[model samples]
Target: MPAGVRVTLRTDSSSLVCRYQADPAPTLNGPGERARIDVVCDGRRADTVKLETHGGDAGFRCEGLPGRMAAPGH
Candidate 1:
């Protein structure tokens, strides 16, 4: 992944799971510093996700998300 890259997904469930495989060589920051990912919901900032910098296959889980609700009318 490069700078200014964005990944988006849509789900109806109130929970989300994100997984990624990364190598430590490409990381400019050290293990002590972690990247912060901004999670956007409906074009608005909903939450901030802090990534684990240890590298390799790892993921994060988010619960209690404000999922989309059915409107009054179809």
Candidate 2:
């Protein structure tokens, strides 16, 4: 797992869904260490995904998000 990561998506839809996997207990560092993934959408933070190394398939839903994906040059 990386220290920090960022992902940006453009959409007009207020409702959004996210599916991800996290390794909260990453063995890459030592025996066991806590790890988590942060989710941010359109400058707005949606949630923080807690993971457990082998943890699989997590879902997140966000509604009423602000902003529309502008088409290049007004």
Candidate 3:
């Protein structure tokens, strides 16, 4: 299998909320193929989201809201 692509997202202390939407069109083949997605916030590791290349073409909704501080001095 070929190596997947990497996508980077950055956020700040003031701006903690974020949202993303995927295109509602299929552009690949196979049912077992996978698409890897990574989301980072405030220069720290935040969340890693993944989706399977199945169920036909469909749009996706991703959101990142403010949560508990990762560090104490936040």
Which candidate wins on TM-score?
1
Model 3 agreement with the true structure over 1-74: per-residue lDDT tens digits: 22565554333343333334445534447775555445555455456555544444332334563543444332
lDDT, residue 8, model 3: 48
What residue runs in model 3 are displaced by over 4 Å at the alpha carbon? 1-33, 52-64, 67-74
Q: What are the per-residue Cα lDDT tens digits for candidate 1 across 1-74?
A: 35676886766678777878776433545566556677666666777876654447655666767777533331
On residues 1-74, what C-alpha lDDT tens digit does candidate 2 reach at each position?
56656666667766667766643423356755455556556455656655534355555556655557645532
Candidates sorted on TM-score, descending: 1, 2, 3
Q: How well does each candidate superpose onto the true structure, as a TM-score?
A: 0.67, 0.45, 0.34
Ranking by lDDT: 1, 2, 3
Model 3 TM-score is 0.34
Model 1 has a clash total of 0
RMSD of 3: 6.7
Output the TM-score of candidate 1: 0.67
